[model samples]
Target: MRALALLWGCLALRASAALTCPKEMSGFEGDTVTLRCTYESELRTHPKYWCREVGVFISRCSSKIFSGENSQDVMEGRVSIRDSPGELALVVSLRGLTLKDSGKYWCGAQRLGPDEACPVSLTVVPATAPEATAPEATAPDAAAASPPAGSSRPTTQPDSSSSAVGDPGPASSSHSSMPSVSIPTTRLLAPILVLLALLLAAGLIALSTHMLWGWRQALWAEDAQRGEKVHLPAAARREEEAPAQAPEAEETSAPCRSEEEEEEEEEEPDPAKFIAV
Candidate 1:
């Protein structure tokens, strides 16, 4: 009997040492969620996995989404798993969850015996829409309460006709004649307009600067062309003057040579006359 009791206690202790995980988790569609599963330190070296449970009656993790052998991270599609040996835990991440992903899952570790696993129910729901803001209420205009222009106030006089009969003279309406007007706030429009104005101003400034720069460049080109034209005309005048001055120099030298020849002939005695003497 004592041996049987001891065996039962061992089984209970073994059951108590199973993997631990959250009972339920929830996430919105297109959102990501993280789950941490802890296990005994002895199972730290075992391969860890995060998988979906299949079958209605007998649920089992047949669809393994992600698994990791060591402390390295393992990723498959939108699911990822990482084992932490120091913490003796497995971290699983699910991204871009959809409504179809709402089902039971298991955090499991592979061993020689039956794999250690814990059930975790995940719920995925559609994302909620943002709440709409109410329109701002405007106060009634003061001018609307005033009487119309060119209208005189009539004086009220005591009635002398009725003595005994109670008379409710005129039913004064309590309702205001002015209609309620709702003014839409232009909170976003102001910034958009300012941005557009700034962009337009910047464009105009850029265009003006470009036009001015182009005009200056054209002016500079025209000035350079004018300078070249002026320089070419002066150089042509100098070349033409050079040929004219050369002819004048040759004519002056011809007269000087004629005078020298006449002087020399007159200075020398005639050789024929000397022979005759």
Candidate 2:
């Protein structure tokens, strides 16, 4: 039992020793990438395969690839494997890579020491790079097109670039020829603001007038309730008093009584006074 356990431990250690490849290999999706691995003469007899990496080791690898010079060629779906007898090298061809194919992988021979297994990290990039577009081709204008030889019109080759480079550039001319904004500003906004201000002033005046009138009316009503009456005009009061004093004026204008009638009545005495005597 002890000997069996030791053998198992040694096998596990050998399986753990993985070979090394390019740490990171990047390629565009749908493109083919070649992975070349070299091995020793002792490993030439071992079966080789490719696998997805797990942790530090390889797992879920391809089927055992035929090794030996007799079967020099091997092909799977999109993958191909070849062992070159001259250089003692193993070459793996992976094709039609997708973005999902980017990850760690392993390439190795079966039952070889862990050092023979190769761990490669593959990075598949998107293949959708933008292509450059060519500028549009326009027919030359009549002035710029060269005239046919031997014509007597003496056609001058109009510099196609003359318009672009004038006394003042088109950009400068555009800047200089800008429309006057002051006119529109004064014509459009100034009048509207003035009209709004005038309306506001008129509204304020109307409000003030209404408020003053209401306050005056309220004061007048309160005065009337308190009986602080207003004095009437002289002519109106005189008209009102004239009939009220008519009888008093008539009595005051009458004649006085006689003094002689008062002296004759002085000898008479009361009847009760005479009986007491």
Candidate 3:
């Protein structure tokens, strides 16, 4: 019976400990809201502190009103923390909060004894005002202003009467009006004829250049043929002159070879003369 009672007590305590801070809470720009956190009997020894976490940095705001000794900056003068006569309350009065103040706030409870800290989340939803522009206010009024909501008077404008007479009818047969159109005539054909004559002269010049190039090419071909015919006679004369010079040059060279052969024969060592020496 004692063991069963202990088990039941543990289960009940676990169930009660599950109650934590609210997951999310939001308020208007000029309103006040409480980021709430409470403890079960198991965690009553630890005091709870509500803090704001912005980009891995945590700032402590309120604490200890829920249970044990805790600290907060609000305990000074930046904010006010109050516990009513009966309610376990954390009232945070924010003044004119903007979107910059919106962030993840943490309600962390640190145990008095050696125990791990537990934390819950609080999301601040800062209110926003409808955007306005000076241009929007100064724009032309599309619709006229309405009367007071309860008034029964109609808003329609009064009908306007015509003041101008009708247009004068077509002119009588006594007078006739003729509209005249003046056409500008240019002496353009004379300039165009002059430009065509200049173009014809340019074409004649280009044709003369082509004929001159052909005549130059024909003269070059004739000169080339005459040079080829003269080359044969010139080469024949050079060949005849070369044969006449060749006889004299070879006659001069023949004695050198003969003298070399004679010197070689005379330089042969004689066996009998060598033995006498």
The TM-score leader among the candidates is 1
Model 1 lDDT tens row, 77-192: 88888988888888888888777777777787777656677777776656533222223211222222222221122212222222114441321111123222211123335667
Give Cα distance to truth, residue 239, candidate 3, Å: 36
Root-mean-square deviation per candidate: 24.8, 25.6, 30.7
TM-score of structure candidate 2: 0.38
Q: Over the stretch 6-112, how does candidate 2's per-residue lDDT look in tens digits?
A: 45433433332333345456555577788877767766666766766432221334344554465466787777888765676777777787776666666676663
lDDT of 3: 0.42
Q: Assess each prediction's global lDDT (C-alpha) against the native.
A: 0.63, 0.56, 0.42
Better candidate by lDDT, 1 or 2: 1
Error of 2 at 169 (Å): 31
Query: What count of clashes does model 2 give?
Result: 2
- Which pairs clash in the backbone of model 2? 17-114, 19-117
Question: How good is model 1 by TM-score?
Answer: 0.41
For model 2, the stretches where C-alpha displacement exceeds 4 angstroms are 1-20, 54-71, 112-115, 133-277
RMSD of 2: 25.6
Error of 3 at 229 (Å): 47
**How do all models score by TM-score?**
0.41, 0.38, 0.31
| Residues 47-130 of candidate 3: C-alpha lDDT, one tens digit per residue | 444445321121233323232233332543233443221333333333444444444444444443332223333223333232
Worst 10 residues of 3 by lDDT: 167-176
